[model samples]
Target: MRDRFLTGLIGYPIAHSAAPAMHEQAATALDAHCHYQLIEVAGAGRDDLRAMLEGVRRLGFAGVNVTFPYKEAVVDLLDELTPDARAIGAVNTIVVDGTRLVGHNTDATGFARAIAPLLATKSRGAIALIGAGGVGKAIAFALAGLGAGEIRIFDADAAKATELADQLQGGVAARSVATAVDGAAGLINATPVGMLPNRDTPVPDTLLHPAMWVADAVYSPLWTPLLSAANAKGATVLTGRDLAINAAADAFALFTGMTPPVAVMGNAFDAVMAARYSPSA
Candidate 1:
């Protein structure tokens, strides 16, 4: 039997990732022997990805999380994909069972859990979503699952938004808009505009109003400019921390084969956030 459960993350520029801390904390809370490592594959090609996956499997890693450019690229290399991963066209978590590598996506589940607390009020009307990439696709499907009435998607690459809209046409009353529409019940920023080192807002401040709810997927700073503006205007806001923490908890469960202590994982993430975003830091 394996004494230590080994897992890792495969991504470029992952030196600042908080996943290791969260998973390690979860391991302790569950009284398990787990070691989560980071395997940086910066600028890796398909052949490189194949090699890394092979090496990790041979090394007996339970699983690994994929991020950024490799999420979609790693799908074809997996032996099988979960239904959510297949529909979202991305895989964020890969589980190695014996010789079979199964791909799963926790982003959708995480996003759904993140927005759940607000759905009671936000699900009544239309939702304006920015960006239509991997995370965007997952959130779009999550919104449908949450019973959002209508979804308006906008991307700088107009075709991307249109394509996502077409995918959700029959399921949800979704359409592509040229820009952020006014008077929507909720607005979401799924782009990386407000991420660390970048303070730009994806949608203009004028598009935000006190009557709407706002959610940003960028959590490094926690209080993104978009969320800050929404807060100042009296709009209800949801930060990226909830999404990040919940997703990490779900991935930890997949890696260790144990029920995750979500509260402990959340507290661990809070500690990471405070340390990273503190004024003294």
Candidate 2:
């Protein structure tokens, strides 16, 4: 039996990634003995990213999770992209089939799974999104697929937001955070604003209201300032934990061709969060 697997994450500021622990733990539980490393590169350009992907291919790595600033940019560098990835215009998971690197977007699938239970009650009427990069693109497409009436996107880069909106057809580009959240039924943060070491939020707490449901894609803290304020304001809240774990499970399946033990991954994620919050390191 093939008993070894090598996979990893590739992105900058990925010290907060739970991919290694989650994947390794799930694999170890199945006696596969997986090794998931973190390839943290800062300010990598297209050429640098090209080199890294080549290194992964040369080093016999199973695959790697592309995150943050690289997901969309990595699309053009891959050999092929899955239908979902092409539709979302982003790639969060890359599956290596021999020499072929196939890009896939598990972010959309993961977020859909994470928020499915709440969709019946929460308003999918109009959503305000804080990022227009890869994750945001996946979420917008996912919501649209799930029958969202409208997606209002706002990014620090107006062009990016406009681009995403143009793609969505049902999407709108909001000029400011205030405009984005104005009468929004739900607010979601797809940026890195509230992640650890950067204890800030993209939107002010005043914008959150009891009538809104909120979600954040940042799981480093699990409880980001944006979700925190939303929770405090009596809004329905969805943490990034479920989305992270679910996406990772899907990515693991692509990496190892085995059904991931999702419960084990969930436990691993809980452990990572516990250690992060534990006072006695």
Candidate 3:
């Protein structure tokens, strides 16, 4: 039996990624030998992506997770994609099967899994989803799968939001909005705003209400400004940590064919967060 498996993540500005520790620790708990690496290809172009994909396979990597600026682009280079990934038009995880590379999007399922506990007994309603980028698209689909009745999308790039809404027409009543929809049942932030080094919230504080449920995709700090404001307003909140850990768990399963130790992965994630955000170096 092979004693070791190797995995990695490909992205620009991945210095803050918690995936490596989470997957590595999960592998340890499962009595498996695995090494997870960070392959930061900052400012990579089309030719660079192709080379990176070819290089990882040639180097015997089991798989790799793709992030920002590359998730959508990686799809064309892959031999196949999981159905959900195809529908979401993005690929965050890729598996290398010998010479064949397959793509999969765990973001949608991961977001769904993370929020399942919150919505188990609650009624589904209209969602105000901010951002229509890759992550936004994934969450929008996840919301549709959750049986959401309607979704209002707001993106700085109006055409992108319109395109996403048009694509989601059959699944959910999606519409591109000029601004955050007032009085929506839930508010989700899928953009990079409120992430580390950027303290801006996707929407203004006045838009938040106690009646709404709030979720953010920025998990590095765990307690983002948007989530904090939502919490102050007495809204039920889901931080980026919830999304990140769950997504990491799903990707780990894809890379290793094993059910990840969620508790272990969560702890590993917390450790990384602490080191990254601690007051003292």
Candidate 4:
């Protein structure tokens, strides 16, 4: 008999997340009666999130994915945290069992795995990362684990950038977009600057050279301005979709203990993208 269960994603302003469709499709392909939904917890604080956690377990949900402001805020509310999430000080995936809530940071591993194969022979080079938010921290730590030589973080909140740098025990150079891109072999955008409504780029196009490898964590628009500019400059580009695929793959393993059918998941994501953005779909 197939296992019947429930799983969902929890976040504020999560109408744009692809988690429900991706997870539901994966469960269907596996012949498992699993349902995934999106739970938007508005004005969600610790107590509010705890209520949702309790509700999911009571309702027999297998797990739930956490996103945005809650990634760090939910840490203290978790019953247990995986070492990786602990190391990065953030949690994007949470599994609830009875009274215990286990938190995991799959973004770090996911981004690393997604971009590893695409990186040039000089994978072990200095990288400049913009934005130091939840995802930014995960990506920074992921790059460090992937053997990146140096990571320089820049954020409007310099203290946040400095804090992330301190966690890496590496050089924390505070420089503007122009100065930060100097001699950097890789550039990563972990901020929301290039998302749908905000098409403006955090870094100048002039700073982007043909030699650098660029990756953006925002997947909403798919063709973010940052990625567009990087691509125009002939830099090897990694899209937000790439990160989504890898992160969803990791989440599949976490939510259901099986290797994900990546092809099916990819197709589903592409279909969703097409439906949302295609002019004549």
TM-scores for all candidates: the values are 0.93, 0.96, 0.94, 0.93
C-alpha displacement of 46 in model 4, angstroms?
2.8
lDDT of 3: 0.85
Per-residue lDDT tens digits of candidate 2, residues 196-242? 88889999989988998999999989888888889999999999999
* Candidate-wise lDDT, in order: 0.84, 0.89, 0.85, 0.82
Residue pairs with colliding backbones in model 1 are none
- On a 0 to 1 TM-score scale, where does candidate 1 land against the true structure? 0.93
TM-score of model 4 relative to the true fold?
A: 0.93
Q: Pick the candidate with the highest lDDT.
A: 2
Clashing residue pairs in all predictions, respectively, total 0, 0, 0, 0
The TM-score leader among the candidates is 2
Query: Which one wins by lDDT: 2 or 3?
Result: 2
lDDT-based ranking: 2, 3, 1, 4
Cα lDDT for residue 89, model 3?
A: 91
Question: What tens digits encode model 4's per-residue C-alpha lDDT throughout 116-209?
Answer: 7866465566688998888989998888887777788888898888888889886545556666678998888988787766789988898999
Stretches > 4 Å off in candidate 1 = 1-3, 171-179
